[model samples]
Target: MAVRAGLPRITARVHLDLLQSEDGRRTAAELTRRLKVSPASVSVAVNYLVRHGYVRRERDPQQRRDVYVIDDEAWYRSVVLSARQTLETARAALASAEGAGPDDLVGQRMARTGAFLERISLDLLESADRWRMLLK
Candidate 1:
């Protein structure tokens, strides 16, 4: 339900399927079988999550299977990475706004947004570190 709330139907289903499994890991076939989803659907969803660093993939040599594991730090990594990405985006915004005329509305909006994101990025990093320290 939580997954469904945050993700599209297929991706949520895949995440839930693996999360509900016994060991927090499953082969793509296993996920497909469990969710009764098409292989391509699983592949797409798994790839998306993996690309976002939410899922960790490994290969089983003997079984020749691709196992997808739910990363314990999935949330942390996702948040931190997004924050860092926002930082980069903000930098770009600031650069683009550099030569704009003083009355440029777009430039003004960009500047404000960039400054906000910059602050948010720093706050997010600080909070993430604090959370990590608390967890330890």
Candidate 2:
């Protein structure tokens, strides 16, 4: 599911594994062992997930190791981030449309695309907010 949503395969696997873990957290060593992947691979995947807001990293105080966690709010954060990116794309598209001139065919298409994306982005954010309220 994560891969389909555009995550790399290894990163998706790491995410799923962490999501399924009893504690919603796993160390790199644990992920490597469980997923039968190299430690370096897990590191790269986790780093990507962390940077993308899909996962968070924390130090395991007792073990002195890094743990990757997928908290309950992970999905909300990811959706919000995605919506923001969409809005950025929309803005760029609209700017390009303006530069291309109002009557140009390409400009018209871009304007429509930009409007659609902007609407979708706003809807996603609104839905996320409603779901967050319901969940809480």
For each candidate in the order shown, give its overall lDDT on alpha carbons: 0.85, 0.90
Among all windows of 10 consecutive residues in model 2, the one with the lowest summed lDDT is 127-136
* Model 2, span 36-78: residue lDDT tens: 9999999999999898787899998998899889867878988
Which RMSD values do the candidates have, in order? 2.5, 1.7
Q: Give the Å shift of residue 49 in candidate 2.
A: 1.1
Q: Enumerate residue pairs that collide in model 2.
A: none
**Model 1: how far is 94 from its true place, Å?**
1.8
lDDT of 1 by residue, 1-136 (tens): 7554577689888887777878889998888898998999999999988998879999999998899999877888888998999999988888766667447988888888888889999899889978975433
Give stretches of model 1 more than 4 Å off.
Answer: 1-6, 101-106, 133-136
Q: C-alpha displacement of 89 in model 1, angstroms?
A: 1.9
